[model samples]
Target chain A: MVRRDEFVLNVELSAEPGEVIVLLGPNGAGKSTLLEVLAGVLRPDTGRISVAGVLLDDTARRLHVDKARRRVGFVVQDYLLFPHMNVVENVAFGLRARGMRREHAQSHAIAWLERMGLEGFERRKPRELSGGQAQRVALARSLIVDPRLLLLDEPLAALDAGSRPKVRAELRRHLESYPGCTIVVTHDPIEAMLLATRVVVLESGEIVQDGTPSELARHPRTEYVARLVGLNLLRGTASGTVVEVGPHAVVAVAREVSGAVYVAFPPHAVTISTDRPVGSARNVWPGRVTDVEAHGDLVRLTIDGTVPMLADVTPVAVADLGLGPGSDVWASVKASEVTVYPA
Target chain B: MTHRRPHDWRVPPVILVPALVGLGLLLLPMAGLLWRAPWARFPDLLISESVVTALRLSVMTATAATALSLLGGVPLAWILARSRLPGLTVVRGLVTVPLVLPPVIGGVALLMAFGRRGVVGSWLDQLFGVSIPFTTVAVVLAQTFVAMPFLVVAVEGALRTADHRYDDIAATLGASPWLIFRRVTLPAVAPGILAGAVLCWARALGEFGATITFAGSFPGTTRTLPLEAYVAIGAGDIDTAVVLSVLMIGISVTILIALRGRWMRAT
Candidate 1:
């Protein structure tokens, strides 16, 4: 348990060796706080934290290990590379602090930096490097220490949009090569999906959902997760092939689920028409166009009606339908497209 | 697009006139000192035994005082800047009392605390037969008492402004607090410490009231350059006094120039 201000975070978390778990959450969701606790920078009020079977913190017994001895490497959001030290000196800091010879530490740090594709930049200061370069140096600094557990908070959030994808891929490769369990915190769903072997969704200081990327994409448990995965989710009571969601009935491919359940379908699966859609579709509702946004090649239209939903149509289709905010429209989804799962 | 030239900017006479007057007021004394200096016997007077001894003593004690201040002031500054303890504002105000307190009053306070028959001084005398007044040690103590506040204030400001996240980063990198302070905090705040030390040294070199009261002026013992100049003036040796004043002005100008950027911004 950790109480900061009026926010209280009580979570029980564990990771196996070689598992890359991404803590996915929005800002102020206690993602960074969790990392700080794991790194021993902030002691939890009451908990038992043991890394690799070595007891690091047990508030019950008043056994809290000092942060310096926790052996947990944390890469902060801003990649706080020491402004005073050169790249090599910053990377070698941990080794030097642990009593290793300066020459030995430098050689080791150089090897690590070279592996990170940062050769000949040893003499450069942090300010001299680009955002991506500084991030790599921060990573090398933490990884060279060979910590038992690694925590990265928004590892690629500092990069420019053009460089984020490249750095994210490179970070993924580095995380895979590390032998220890790694927990990455990020608000970007795409980043979480790309990096995490398992994703834990946190909201309001609680874990709302924990599953693999595909599992979450297929059956998101909450509206936040559904929105993050670009799906329309509706909670309702289900019986056989139909679920009564809000004021509208959604038909799904035959499933054995009953009682409280969630109905989900991709935005692409939703079709919109200026007039009522006529098809074999089992679910249809008339709604006014609430919002229209250009999403890559498709224009996503948010329709508000008996069953509020989002539909993705091409720009040409949007032109034909004359879709804009306040335009009356009908949204339909085929029974096969709707997925039903227990709430 | 056209750009404004540097000369396009102007300072209004309302502000510029008095600013110039203030500058002139400050420079007039140095000009008078230089004009009245004994250039003819300057070499003879500069190398005199008393002048040399006093100069040596001033430099030695000022440096010793600066060093002592650094030893105790840095940690005190860290606590003042970072500690979350209650009443720290009061403690910080108390630490700066010496900066505003008259040096003679500070000298009297020091006498009450460390002089023979004084609080700590009486105990030391009873146990070890040690006496501090009228000695070189007393001169250093008095100088440190008056000058250390400068170092502490400067360092505390620097620490307060420095990025504290770096300490957390160092800790996560497996650095003990002592190691972090030695390798990271110390290096990061070095410029502040250097500037503070310079100020402390300058103040100590000019210290007179506290030294004269707490440590009596004795040639070759505690009679620093300032005391020597005072003695010269008391004996009506106007030429020697002028020479000493010119020397001090030269030293002060050199320090001001060396620390112009940091000192100006600090003030």
Candidate 2:
């Protein structure tokens, strides 16, 4: 899908019933564009999209379903609850449009509202509800139609920092109870980890990696994913268990690999010292500190050397080593902490 | 709400003088009309045969003209504001041409297009044995010619400013285009439509040049209040003219006040 020439979405993925697939990517990575295509709001330029074995779109066959006819529930980041409609009316909108009687549709809407934990907000307008309440109302509105596929675009992004965790947990519960193919688009790694059964990493309109949350955290293929997961990634050539990241820098991992490879280890795994360490670890590099930053209880140091690396040291250790910009130091990590994989 | 800000006392004379002058310019004429009105004979003058007939005819023709404008102008406004038809800019410009055209010129243009011996009028006369000029129907056509732009322009602006995302959401909820229009779009823009109808009615009721030029002033058949006032002045019956003018002003002000409280204030 070409979204206003903003970005091209070249996604080939699917979600099974009872499974939630999170599209994890930074802004403008076409995560929302892919969701729109699946929701039938945006048509794909050239591709086939089938949900539960029904072809929603097939460019070669010249078959496409309009947004209205597609049985997909879309909950956008803004919640987009009709401001003029009270909570009950907003939730009953789909049933009313489907030709249900007013009383019956409203009764069903009330039931959905109660399920969403919005029992007393039935008469409140959208503007009267809190952010979390509005989100629940939007979800109830979309789910009342019993859609075959559910699409959520940054469902928790609109909540404040203090309420995000609470709403995130609630949304995860709702997604778990929903018996439909689910697709969620988000840029927050914590949200993705908490909500997704499987995470698909999107970068520059392409799927860079797709795996379970733990699997992606342990092995990220792209710098974007690595940065999101707080890992230091280096691309180099590998022979056996050693990867040549620089002229004098090599990392030894547990796996034996050859040719192009990506090596990753979390910043917390690296230790910084004023002098070269005498240890059995397989990776060590002497470098000059380029930048220093405070990360909670730890101080992060960016070092320039044979291989640029980030090391997270405790504040006490940083004080002991007098680590600052332009200071010389050696950073070391054990061989077991580094993971090497084919590019 | 009435807590006034302290006066700066540095009011610019240039603005204050003209502002008061403009208010006086509008209010002085109404005051003069009221001063000269024959209050004692107002009841007798209002109940006269000619005055009653002209008032009745004016209300009927203007109402008809307003209904016609609503029927045609509303759909035109929707198309102009919502459709992706090519060369829409040109179509939109043409729709507003009536607003800028002088009513007499519009009357002449209408006559040229719908006259008995001219263009479509000739075909109409031949095919249906219908001649529209100098008839009550001609009065409605003339008023509509000069008044339709108000409705179309108002409704089009409303349509453009309304939140179209609601329409998209409604469609995704399984509403067809027609149902969306009737239930969602129409209710959202009702204030604009009501305001437009009020403007169209007032313009039609006060129409003189176009109605006189195209339909002529035949006593009960085509003569409306404004035309009757003109005739009264021509006959040197200044009292009758004053009575008719006062009645027209009174009716328009009452209706506009009622509408303002509900529709125009929605802006």
Candidate 3:
């Protein structure tokens, strides 16, 4: 439904109807701006935009479609509901703008509220709605227009942590039900993975990575993505298979390393030791504890030595080892567990 | 952010006393007039036909003047607040000239522009075979000339300080510029417009020098409440004058209270 001659999006986006695409980035990634350009609110500075085979913005010829004429819906970051209008009125506003009669438009608005499970709350004002409910109202308001393209800006962003999961699920269902091309913009990787069929990661206004959730999990290209996938981060120097961290700790890696190399291992693979155990695992370090943080059923121990290592342990192991800040401990890891790459 | 406001509650009594006393000073004359007003003759003064005509004329013409201001001043304020037009500062200043210019000068300016023998008045008279000065229309124009700027300035300030996101939301929701203004912008600024309208209408009702100079002090034609009160005082009819003054204040207070609730609920 969408095409452009030399769209030059840098990353190819070819989604069939009802497919949801998530654009993930850390603030100022040009995600919302891209959506605005697509919606015809902003003119593409050097490209073309089309939806459902109609030209919207063509910068070359200076042709542009007015935002009102373009059938694209946008849900902004804070769920910009018209405070002057009640929930039903806000939903009907777009339909009325499109020349629908008041009665028919309001009926359509009520139908949309029913779809979002907000039927009984029609007459309530926007400020009176809870965060999740208001978000649903904003969604219903956009969808009632029967648009060809829908753009959501951080749909679950304004939600509290406890309300996020339910709103996220509800939003996912709404996106699936909308029979149109949809794009969701978010900075949360997990939200993108759960909500979008394909996740496009943007950084500094550039698409750094774009793939399915599993693809990104398997081969994360950037340090941020690697960290997000929960890898132990380390910076050090390397010469051939031997890598030196700080002064005393030297480890062997499979890659033909030279100069600077970063070594990472999953916290699960890092084993804690109180003594030098007999093992063939090439990586071991003696260190004092710096900090301990609980993550779910495991405790992550931060130990400092020639090479600082993180050891994840269960509650039983923690009690037995008495690990805490300033506690003496030894950490060990298998050579196979460490993944090394040139910096 | 500065957490501590160093200037709070430390003012010298010398400034605050007279500042309050000045208000008391302004209100004392009205209180004295009421206290000394002839109670027995109040019925005669209140039921006088001329007084009734002037009060009704004042109420009707002030409202008409307010309507005229809203019809023209709102769009001008919106443009001043939103657009990037050249010479806008000068235009805004020009719009506010009525607030600073003497009412007599404004009356003369209006007279020159629309009077039968004046600059644009000649062509208007020739084309329409009509005269504006010394008519009810002249009364309305003169009041609007001196009062509409209040509505424009208040509304423009409100527009400038308003939450601008509603317009953006409306635009994204497929509202055209005109639709956005009509729906979002107007509702958001309605309180300010209402407040300004009340002030404009009150000022219009109380207009004296401009109405008398431009519209002339003819009986039953251009004689509004304020002009009636001025003439009664000049004719040594002090009780009738107080009655008219009280009537104007009463109407102004009623309008203010009526609009106050609208603004309160809006906010």
Candidate 4:
């Protein structure tokens, strides 16, 4: 779809039934905009949107379905629960809007809330619920309508770190049981990996990569995706098994891929040594440590050499090798650890 | 609880002096009204037929005017707050014109617009033999003409400040625009609507210049509380005028006090 003079997004990915397609992008990359377009909250300049064979919007035909009739459930990032409504009222909102009898809606809402493990929270206002409970209520509210296409924007982003894991797991279970097309938008790689059956990477309002979680982790196309997957990406010309990255420096890859190719290896795969390694490591380069940072239980050393590389070493290893800024070190990687793929 | 002193030591002379002066300035007239009031004949004056007629007329007209203002002003406020129509700023400025315009001038403007042989009134007269001036309908129209701005302005501010995302969410939940308005928008801005109604009712109750100029001061028809107060004072019946003024003040204060709890609780 095109937004005149601002940005043009050309995305064409379809979600299969019961498949959770995670739209992964940084801020201002049109993830939320795409969600809005699908939910009928926004009218695309020129596009045709059909959900489950029902046309929702057709700009060329000048036919735009009303948002209220789209049969699409949209759960925004902040939940956006009505402040004046209690949990039961919020959950029953969709049914009531669809012209359900008030008593039937209330009973259905209670059943949904019970299914969400929120039986006692029926009368509690939105503000009174904790972050996890609020997220559950939002999920319940959206799911109660049994929409054909469910759109969730950063479902777990508003949650605090303490409750994020439990809520994320619960949300995944709910999504797995949903028998409709689901599109979730998020920037966190872990959330994408945990929730997405397929990941669609968006960069600058364009689709850069679309693949399964393992495929994306194995072969990332951009630096952002590479960083997100926690892999060091290097682009070089490959001739057979040897890839020439810089002058007088060639790295050997186990797989033979000719022409332009990319090699990615985990930061932990690169073992830092004070001297040149005298082992089965095929790729080794002497470089100066540019920066040092703590990554979980390991110390990540940023090395400037033939190619900028990230090498993770344990804190004990850092003390043993005296690794710090401006320190000269040899970064080595096993040929088997590097995954080479066509660019 | 410990015994309390008559005056707190923390009261600074600068603030205390002006505060007391301001209190005296406000209360001095009320004190004088009470001091010169015919207490022995107070019940007799209140029960008099003219006083009863004017009081009843004031209540009924003010209520009708408030109802009219709410019905018209709410839609206007919604348009101002939600729509991006052209010349909206100008329309909003014009809506608040009555708030700043002198009541007498507003009455004249209403006369020009709704009076017999005037603009719409001329058409109304020739077409239907209906005249608005010098009638109970005229009193209500005059009150609404001068008091609607308060309701519109208050409700507009509330609508502007209210979260519109709730409306968007409601729409996505399959609620039509009107349903969304009734269930979501109305409740969200109910306090503002209530406050505006109160202000409009109070202004209508005390309306003098507008009702007299546009509707005329006819007993049992348009001589409301403020108009009655004016007539009483002009006729040298200071006791009646004082009593009418105090009654108007008392009614307004009572209503405000009664509603304060509800508005505060909602907020």
Q: Which numbered prediction scores highest in lDDT against the true structure?
A: 1
Kindly give the stretch of ten consecutive residues in candidate 2 chain B with the minimal lDDT sum: B258-267
State the local distance difference test value for candidate 2: 0.89
Residue A85 of model 4 has an lDDT of 91
Candidate 4 wrongly placed segments (more than 4 Å): A2-10, A120-124, A246-250, A276-280, B1-27
Name the 10 consecutive residues with the lowest summed lDDT in model 3 chain A.
A1-10
Give DockQ per model, in order. Answer: 0.76, 0.52, 0.58, 0.70
Model 2 TM-score is 0.91
What TM-score would every model get versus the actual structure? 0.94, 0.91, 0.83, 0.93
Q: Give the TM-score of candidate 1.
A: 0.94
Q: What is the Å distance of residue A60 in model 2 from its true position?
A: 1.9
Question: Highest DockQ: which candidate?
Answer: 1
Residue lDDT tens for model 1, A16-58 = 9999999998788899999999998899998999999999999
lDDT of 2 at A89: 92
Please give, as one word, the docking class of candidate 2.
medium
Between which residue pairs do clashes occur in model 4?
A: none
What tens-digit string does per-residue lDDT give for candidate 2 at A136-227?
99888899998889889899888999999999889999989999978999999999999999999998899999999998888888888998
- Position A323, candidate 1: lDDT: 77
lDDT of 3 by residue, A1-343 (tens): 1223533333335566877888887776678777877777566657667778888777788888887878888898899898889999999998787778999999989988888889789999999999999999888888887888899988888989998999888888888888998999998888988998877787665687878887666556566766677766676799888888676778777667889777777888888878876798778778898999998889988788877766788878888877789988878888887888766
DockQ of 4: 0.70
